[model samples]
Target: MEIGFEELPVMNLAFVIDKSGSMNAADKMGWVKDAFGIFIDRVRDIDFVSLVVFDSSAR
Candidate 1:
């Protein structure tokens, strides 16, 4: 199933994450990435999404 982004209204999204070494444990990063991927899939192309991943600092 797919939602057409062209007809969707414009919106803003923000995704914050931790990229520290501890996040690499127990497949945490994998799970987070997977979840984010699925979530981003739901966003429309006309919308804006921001991904902010930080470990020791915000980049």
Candidate 2:
């Protein structure tokens, strides 16, 4: 039996990021950015991506 990759559904991903003062400690925020860059590069063109960042306020 053979599987059809084209028949699979597209992926939707949402990432919530923390931007508070604590995130600046020990370069935690830098790590998050680097990880996110790696992830976004691996996603297919058909995939959807959304990001939400929060600190004292969110936008």
Candidate 3:
């Protein structure tokens, strides 16, 4: 059995991203951004998302 998008339920997603100075190392920040972009692409239109970025702080 398989479930299609029409049968899927709404979702709520919360992402806590790390933006410390080290994140810039090895292009980690860029990689995370690209990965998150793909993740966002997979979200349903009715879903909700909250992104919190932190680096020795929360904003």
Instruction: Highest TM-score: give the candidate number.
Output: 3
Regarding lDDT, does 1 or 2 come out ahead?
2
Best by lDDT: 3
Q: Rank the candidates by lDDT, best first.
A: 3, 2, 1
Q: Per-residue lDDT tens digits of candidate 3, residues 1-59?
A: 99998688888889999999999889999999999999998888899999999999999
Candidate 1 residue-wise lDDT, 1-59, digit = tens: 77875765689889889999999899999999899989988877678999898999998
* Angstrom error at residue 18, model 2: 0.2
Taking all chains together, each candidate's TM-score versus the true structure is 0.78, 0.84, 0.88
Relative to the true structure, candidate 3 reaches a TM of 0.88
lDDT of each: 0.88, 0.91, 0.93
lDDT of 1 at 2: 78
**Tens digits of per-residue lDDT for model 2, 1-59:** 77665655798889999999999999999999999999988778898999999999986
Q: Is candidate 1 or candidate 3 better by lDDT?
A: 3
